[model samples]
Structures are given as C-alpha cells and as structure tokens.
Target: MTSKTGAHLRLLGVSLLALSIPMLSGVAHAEDASPGASTSDEASAQAKSGIAEGSDILVTATRANELAPVTASLQATQPQSIISRSFIEDSLPATADFNQIALISPSVSNYGAANGVGLSESKAQIRGFQDGEYNVTYDGVPFGDTNDPTHHSNTFFPSNTVETLIVDRGPGNASQLGQATFGGNINMFSRATREDASAEIKGSYGSYNTWLLRGVLQSGAIRQLGGAEVVLSAQHIGSDGARTYSPFKSNNVFGKIMIPIGPDAKLTILGTYNENSFNQPDKDGATLSQIAQYGKYFSLNNDPNSQTYWGYNHTHKTTDFEIVKFEANLSPFATFDNRAYTYSYDNETLSGSDVTLYATASAADIAKANMVTLTPGGAKTVGVPGYTKTNKYRVYGDIAKTRVDFGFGAITAGAWLEWSDTYRQQRDVDLLTGNPNYVEKAVKDPVTGIATPANIKFDQNSNTNHTEVFAELELRPIAGLKITPGFKHVNFNRRIDADYNQTTRYPQKLSNTYTVNLPFATVNYEVNPALSVYGQFARGFLAPPLSYLYVADPSFSTIKPERSTNYQAGAVYHGHNLSIDADVYKIDFSNKFAQDLTAPASQGVVYYNQGAVQYKGIEGQVTYAFTQAIAVFANASRNYAKTRNPGEARTQVANAPEYTAAGGILYKQGPIRFSLIDKYIGRQWFAEGEPDAYKSNGYNTAILSARYEIGPVRIGLEVNNLFNAKPVTNISPGKTTLFDQYYYQTGRAFTGDVTLTF
Candidate 1:
C-alpha cells in the first residue's frame, strides 16, 4: 500500500475509535434499531395484519412504508433508493426490464427507442455515470463483460425474475465488492421462494403485434427432502417492434431449489437460460436527412439488393447463469456464507456495413462503391457490404463472507475471486451471396508459433483474473448507534493474445495488472424507531479498460486507473402516513480516461487520462398516503458534473442532465388498482467539451397502469408514452451523412395481459 492509502486507513481507525470510546462506557439497556427499521407499534400492527411492509397489497395498507414507490431505509449511511417488487408488479409494464424499472428513480435517465421497451437493450446513467462506470450485482454476485464492466440490460435478469432493486448512490462501505465501485451500485435480488405450493399461467398482447406467454410453478416445502423448496418458470416473448423492419423474439427458463440443513444451515441452487433473436440494422439511429425523407422511425427496408435490408441485419444470442450457495450459523455469535457461480454469453450477429449508405445511393451506386474480388482469378463482383461477428465469453467466480459478533461490536470479512475467458471475431462478407469477400491468408499464432489460414477483419482471445478482499468492524457502542471502519484491496490482471488485433489489424500479445487499496468509514444514529441520520466517506477505484492494451507495445502505456473520493450525508423518516428520504453528496473524481479520437489509427486508438471532475448533487423522495386506497409519490434531483482540465475552461459533462423529476398518483380499492406516473429529464449536451455539440431540451413521458382481480383470474393493462410524445433522447455524429443521427423515444403503446392462478 502507498503512504497515502496507509494515512487514510489510520485516520479512519482513529476517528472510529474516538467515537466509540465514550459510548462503550455507558450502560446499554435499549434494544438495537437498524437504520430502516419501523417503530415497534408499526411492526406490531403489520404482524397482526399478516402483511409485510412492502407486500404486493401495499396500496391497500395504511402504513407509510407500504405506500411508497421508492424510499430509503433508516439504516442507510449513504444516498440510496429501494424499489420493491410490489411497486414493480402494480405500476410497471409486465415486460419491463431493469433499466425501465430504474428509470423511475431520481437521477436516472434511459432511452428506449425504435425497438420499443424491453425489445432491445437500453443504457441507463446514474448521477451522470455511464453504464461501464457503475457496478451491477445480482444476488450479491457481480457480473458483466470482461473487456469493459458494462452490462446488457436485456441479457440477464428481467423484472419478472427480480424481487427488489436498491440503487446505492455512492461507493458503499468496504463490504461492497465489484469491478467499478466509484460511480455507484445497482443491486438486484432474485425472487424469493414461497412457502405455499402454487401454479400460474399468463398471456399478454400489445401494440405492434407483440405477444408474451408464461408459466410458473412452486413446490412449496417438501418434508420428505428435509423441507426443500423449488420454483420453476418459463416464458416466451415476441414483438414486431415500433420501427420498420425491426423485430425481436426471446425464450427464457429459470429454476431454483432451496434445502434446509437443520434449523441453522441452508443450501440453495439456482439456474436460468435465455435465447434471444432480433432484426436491427447496424446503424443504431436515423440521420436528420434520412428521417426527413423516409420518416422518423425508418431503420431498414425490404429491398434485398440494398445494404439496409432487414434480412441481412440480424442477431442471435444465448445466455445462461448458475449459482450454488451455502449458509451456516456455526455459533450464536458467528456465521459463514459462501457462493460459487458461473455464467456465459454467446452472440452471433450479421449486419450491413452501413445502413445509411442505401438511404440516398442507388443500387448501382452502392455496388460500384463496394465492388470486391474474392480470389486472384475471379472478376470484380458487385457485393452488398456486410459483416458477421461473434462474441462469446464465460465467467466463473466464488465469494465467501464470515461474521463474528462481540459484546461491543462485530467483525465482517470477505473475499471475491473471479475469472473470465472471451473469444471475439468479425469477418467481411457479401450480404447478397453470404460469401467471404477476401481470400484466406496464412497467419501465425502469437503464442504457439503455428501458422493458420484466416480471412477476417479481426480475431482475438482474452482473459481476466480479479480478486478483492475486505474486512470491516461494526462498533455498536450504545443503543441506536453504529460505526463501521474498514478497508479493501482490489487487484485485476488482464491478458490478450490476438492473431489479428483490432484497429491496427496486426498480431499482438499484451498483459497488464492494476491494484489499489480503498478505505471506508460510516456512522449512523437512530434518533428514533422511525427516523435515522447517517454520514459516509469512502474511496472508490476502477482499473483501466482492456482497450488500453490495443497497441503494438503495452509497456509504454501511461494511463492510470480511475479513482474517486466520495462524501455523503443523508436522513430517513417514516411517519404514520408519510415517508421521506433525502441526501447530499460530493465526489472528487481523478484520472478520467477516454479514447483520443483525434489520434491516428496507426497508434491503435490511443487512450489518455483527460483530467479531473467534480460531481455534486442533492436528491430526495417522498410518499404520502391520503387514505387506504389513495397515495401520492414524488422525487427530484439536482445534479452537476463539470470537467476541469489544466488550462481549458470548465465544461459540462456530456449527457449529464441538469435535473430530474418524477411524480405520480396511485389508487387501490377492493380488487382494482390504478397508477399514473410522469418522469422528466432535464437539458443536456451531446458531446463533452465540443463547441458544436447539440444541446437537447428537457422532455417528459408518462405511463399509466390498471389492474383488476376476480377470483383466481387477474387482468392488467398498461399504456406507455400515454400522450404519444415523441422526442429525441439520444444523438451522435453521423458516419455517412453530414447531419447528425438522432434516437427518439417510442410513441404511445399499449399492452394487456390475463393471468390465472391455481
């Protein structure tokens, strides 16, 4: 560890010790109250009513916590928001993905265009942090692509399979483990197994010829197998999409089994598989000129001779995830938990070289521009340019955590180890004949000194090894007070051996390793059972992406890992009929890295540390229950992220909204429920530090949901973009046309579903 790291650790230790000494000497008589715990009276009422605080019937309950769509727990030491499964099922569309669900939270923005909601992958930003900058975890296990710590929103766990989502708006305590912790953490938990046997069947139909069929089964608890429980589900969804010639289809199957090993121990196994196929052009959005001439939603056409043909642009993906977990309480004061997991993603895609090419160019003009000779003896052929690409990767990891309690406090320690292997390749092909455009050439392997025949754009194989270890002490010196001080060490090793590397198109082999020490401290005081206040300080770290090594020699690279210092304070309150949470945070970010687009390709896409950034924000959310059948919810955030270079003027970060807001009203009575919510994203720039960047105006979208239950049958209806709003949500400089390309949110769409429970 560096001296700076050591100094921070010392400071944290001293501060924690000083705060605990006086409280430890006092007599302790009151029972412990966790940060988010409710008052004793409220708990007693809930128990008597036989309904959990965040149950699906929350809208019908009179409790404050039950009526809130998004709220924080009283025990939070940093800014956080929790979205319950009840809210998801009652207010959001049944086909909603995690991204859509998160969009309702403060400081979050997402764009679902062309393919409509859940039909295509969507990217979401939190407090101005992009996808690869944050950490996403499922059931306490972190998973993402190896090259970059980015997630595919439509690939893994859908909303139907998730039980809860917690957005931690800061680098949490030492116990939070992931590749990128500086930005924030989006934690997703799997659905819990029920204690009662049941079965359900559902069918849904929506606009644009969308359809979904699903079935679920639960085995309750089987006494014969030591009280083992099981749950299984299968579903299929298809859509024609909102854009022209864009369609999607998916099939998913999931299963989970839990076995009790005595009263103090348990074993759990879970697995899920998904297969997805979609037709979308290579160009993600439509250029201004193309949209003006062919309509705003134009993406592809039916002409077989054109490069924009939908048949020539399609993708297929297969993914699977599995986990085995064991938990045991060795003693009254000690506990242990371990989990081993593995997941894989395989994608095969065929897409036109440029969808914008055929917008203005004639068939003959396109052929002349892309003519190629496949072999030495063959004549020049008028080929429709396209490519076939594949990305396949598998990850294996294990996590172990142990906690031991003492009279004054408790100590928690854990370690996470993971390994990933990936294979990627792309090849130029004639879209018309589905044949290679180039002749095979002999290429020698970078590692084995063996020559092989290959004709492709690029072929590469890479692997990564990651390790993290952390230890923290939770000191509860007195009743309703908790202080934690901890530290963590993270190391990452990446290696790539490419027969034909990207950009440079040459053989290369490279390896690099990064390591850092992070320190964390937090303090929480429960003023009362229904209210709590806390403060947190932590250091976050993220290693350089794999693209940093895509050079002839990686030894000379000077880019450093990104790091951040985060400080935050927050308060949470739960009253009889109202709940509210608010927080303020500031982050000092250093070693911001980006690809130097101005550099020549011969240098293999150079990456450099741009400069520093300062991020500050204030966020809050509230829910008020007017009656057992009516409630109101609201949240807002003011965020500012500015880049500070040595000599350049400070500029706003790209895509960082100035502010965000959401409000809605919900009603539930008898066997009926209804909700209407609206979300707004404030002004933002399209490019960082660019003089000619486009500034987008703020936009608003609303969604309405209604459901009715009769006996064992339930019916639901959802309308997204209820007012038929169409606004540009994303923009990028065009590659083929002089005008910029824009992506707009889909217009009004409706979905209806009927479910039967037995």
Candidate 2:
C-alpha cells in the first residue's frame, strides 16, 4: 500500500478503537465481578436504575432497538447499509428524494446544483462508479430509461412512499437482476398498508418559494375481501428554484392493496402516476466570464430577443408505474413468488441552442452567420433559434422465483424477462413563431434504393428485449456458517428503425444481440449473537450502451461489453452502546470504452475499448449511543481508481472523489427530536483522458433539523447548508470560448412543515 493509503487505514483504526473503549471497559468489569453475585439480579438492578451492565448492554430489547440513521444488518452477506423509515420521518426534509436520503451513507456523493434538493434530476456516484454503472430497484423490480440504465431521481417514487433503503456495495448474488450490476445496488421498498384505518393531511413551506401539500387515507382490514388492506395518497409540490428563471412543479398519486388468499398465499397490487413540468435553459451552467458579468445564479433572462429566454425553454413529462405480485407457500419447505409490472415515461421539451453563443447576437446576425433560417424559403424575422424534442417509451416485464428448503440447505432460482418500445425525435424550430426551420437534404435509402427529401434532424424508433436466468444454493454444513454459490446468464437484443439517422441523416435499419454468463460466491460466519464476518467473490457484466450502435456501418464496429472481477470482505459488530461495520474491496475492470475523437464527421461518433482500470477502497461506519436519548454517528471512505494502459502512467478517474466523510449528533426523547449533520467530499478531476484536466477543490455542507409532537399533530423545521458554503461542484468545457462553465451548490435554505393525523 502507498503511504497515503497506510495513513488512512491507521486513522480509521484509531477511530474504531476509541469508539470501542467504553464497551470494552464495561465487559472487563462485568467479568471481574464476584462469582457469588447473581448476574441476573445485578443486571435487573442496573436496568431499574437506568444503568446498563457491559455484558447486557445490547442484550435488552430497548438498547438493541435504538434508532440509527444508517446501520448494518447482522445477516448481510456483503457490505450493506440500511436506512429505516423512522429516520426519514425525523431527520430528512419532506421534499427529499432517494438521492437526498443517500447522502448520509458512506462512499456516496451528490450535488444537486441550482435546482436544490429534489427539485430536479440529480446524478449520484458510488465509490468511483458513475450513474449508469450501478443498479437501482423499487421493491424488487428494476426500472430505468430504455436507451441506457440511468435514473431520474425526482420523477419516480418520493420519500413519503418509501419504507426502507439498502445500499449494497458489491455485485450481489446471482439472484440480483438489472441492466447494470457491477458497481452496486440501491434497493428501495414501499411502505406497507396499516392494519388500522387512519387519515392524514400534511403541508410544508420552504426557502426559494417552495411549498408542498399532501393527503393520505388508509382502509382497515375488511372481512368482505379476505381481510384486505388498502392505502391511497396524493400530493402536489411547486418551487421557484435557486437559479434565475427556473421553476419546477409536480403532482403525484399512489395506491396499494394487499389481500390474503386462503391461509397460505397473499396478493399485492400497487400503482403510481405522476406529472412534472419545469422551465430551464438549454445550457445548464454558466461560463466564468458570464458568471463574472452577470452573477453565479445567472441562467436565463426575460428578454424575448435572446436565446436564453425562459419562455422559450421548457419541458413537460408524465409517468406511470403499476405492478401485481402473488406469493404462496406450496408446502412446509417450498415457496413461490411472481410479479408482473409495467411502466412508461413521456417527455416533450423545447430548448434553445447554447445561451452564451447568442448572448449578445441578434436574429439577423444569426441568419447572416447561417446558424438559423437555413431553408430556401424560411423566414429570417424569427428570433431565438431552438428545437423541439420528444422522447416517449413504455416497458413491460415479469419476474418469477421459487425457493425450497431442506434439512441441510436451501435452493433459490429465478428468471426475468422484459421488453421495451421507444420513439424519439428532434427538429429545429423558431422559438418565436413555433415553425420548423429544417435543413432540406436529399438522401437515398440504402435498402430501398429510393431518394427522398428530409427536413428534420432525426426521427427513430427502437425496441429492446432483455432476459436473465439465475440459480443459487445456500449450504449450511456446520452451525453458525453458510456458503452460497450461484450463476446467472444474461442476453440482450436491440433493434432500431430510423427514418433519419442521427448525425449522418440517412434512413437505416439495424439490430444487435449480446450474451454473457456470470458466477458469484459468498461465505458468512457468525462468531456470536453480536458479531458476524463475511467474504464475497463475483463476476460482473454490462452490455454496450445504445449510442454505440449509432455508426453508419454496424458491421465495422468492434465495441465489446464491459466486465469486472470483484473481491471483498467485511465485518459487522453490534454490542451494548455501539454498532460498527467495515469492509475493504478491490475490482479489476476491463473492456472500458471511450469515444474516438479522430473519427470523421460523416461516420458519426465511433467508440473503442480504451483499456483496463483498477479500483480499490476502504469503507466503514460507526454509531454509539451515550444514553437512551442521545447518540453520535460517523462514517468515512477512501477510494482509489486509476486507468491502466500499455505504456502510460496511471491517472485518476474523472468525477471520482478521493475521499468522503460524514458525522453527526442525534437526540430523540419523549416527544422531541433533533440532529446536526455535516458531509465532506474530496477533490476530483472534471475531465478524463485530457491533458491538464481541471481539478475541483473539496467542500463540505451542514444541516440542522428539529421536530416536536403533540397529540395528533406533528411539526418539523430544517435548516440546510447552515454555514452557507458555496463551492464549485461541476464543470463543462467550452466548445467556442476560452472559459469553461461551472456549476455550484446552492446556499443556505430553510423548511418548516406540519402534519395532522386522524
């Protein structure tokens, strides 16, 4: 290990040792007590006096059940963190999403930019893996965009509907299914229906002119429907975002029902519908010169003559998700489960070209420069050149699994099949007149041998079919020990039919299919009731993204699917007043892909396998309760990822933080609760495979929250970015100007909420 790595390890060791000192001393004192003394009697006396014996610290139900914002499971086979619903109710803001809730976990980093938390789509990274490198699932079903496996954090499930979240930091066992599973998995589960009937109304108001209102109704178990329980909720939220001329609003509705069939089976049905609308400029950030001339928050203007007008750039999207699941116990030793699901996303957007390019230019100037009004008869009086883009898709899928238990071990097998249909198109238009400003071109159809005139940029349709089959066996040869081995086969088929191809602007039809097999194994041992250790080895895989198939000639493409070999081990300890988990991991990544900058324009962008990469990291988290009402929590990670080439020196991966740390103090008593947390992100490069890449400095932010409850009413207040620290978090290189664009975190903000339950 390098000197820096050694130092990090040493620091982590010291921190863990310090946190264990109190527990260790208590255990030692208990062991040295008089033999004649009754241990049970002593423990009872300590409990009655609010004092805890070292040996019985966590033995009691109260201390063992103490709430921790982020914790580990004693039964986990890999490095994982569990965030419970109780933490969300008391700690996070009502407007929070999955990304905001994940901020407290180890080895995770995200900056939402000027949109504020949960106000817009945000990208988050795990370890050194980017957004599309990992997997995300709701309940147990995987969902994402059809073109690539990327998620929009604000468009789907909200915090109010979530019950629990698990961050699995590895390629899970063979039963885990998704488009990408090598980096890790973020699993989210919905809230369960309540047994008793109840109703609730909630409202919240916050900084940046944000507000939210929600209502919920729960139906108690009914004998008329086999003791079925149902829950329904509706909410609306609106915000004037941190950036100038950018606003956001959304409305959502959710419903769930559970029915007990016979005495050995159950059925569940759930559905969600949402509509979102926002106004934002095409360019996300501002160049340094623009920032200096305007302001850090400058994005769009009210002027109709410029391309940065907010009225000329806006988007509207609608989404829906539905699922039906059935589970049954076939016999005392066998069980079966199946789920059928469908989801869709429809988006329509109008955005202008680069704002900086036309910052001071006029419509006549643009026409003279041939930037707009390219057609022979197109009008030159139209101002603000832009485009109309649309993306609409729907997905259908099913998952079925069965498990059988024997005296020595258990077997699990599952299969997943999914299909998706998508249509996408983009066309240049005059923002003022709402008229198409197409560039006429005569292109011959390669297959039909017919020439036609086309005006639009591109119009295409695609279909994808994905299939996965997996089986695993869990063997328990001895007490307190278990071993699991499994394998999974994956196949993907993609087909595209385009009236006008993207860059080459030609009619084409193409299809491609890829297949791979992956294997996984893990061993876990329980040393005692309070401690456990585990190790895992797995092979991960990901097929090439959709963009790789955009070339003019598919036969000449040589791109390959990405793959990784992972090895990791970890330990978990839960005792008396403390809970701790730690792990170390290494991954050998190959078949990395990068765009070929030298490719000719006529051929469109081409991709090639660049080289291999080595990723290694250490991660840990600890929580200690000083008393029944107060606790302290801390977590840290040191990550290293570098590219490896034939005769080149290793370089750091772009957008991957060097290190991350978070800590906080939490207090929970009778009817009041409070917490203060701070998170830190380390330095990172903004661009990869470029000479003299720009590097961003590290930064940290803090939040404070408090809550109080009385009878059926609950009130909460949260202060974010308490110190008002604003630092650059992202950069986009300029294509024409010498100065690059930068994106910064929003300043301090506050929120207050109230809820009434009946």
Cα lDDT tens digits for candidate 2, 79-146: 87667666777778777788778778888887554678778777778887888888888767888888
Q: What is candidate 1's lDDT per residue for 407-517, written digit by digit as tens?
A: 688777878899999999888788888887663454555456665434476889999999999887878888878788888999999999887776445677778899999
- The residue pairs in collision within model 1 are 35-74, 35-75, 36-74, 36-75
Error in Å for residue 107 of model 1: 0.4
Model 2 C-alpha lDDT versus the unseen true structure = 0.73
42: Cα error in model 2, Å: 37
Models, CA RMSD each: 8.1, 9.6
TM-score of each: 0.89, 0.89
lDDT against the true structure, per candidate, is 0.74, 0.73
lDDT of 1: 0.74
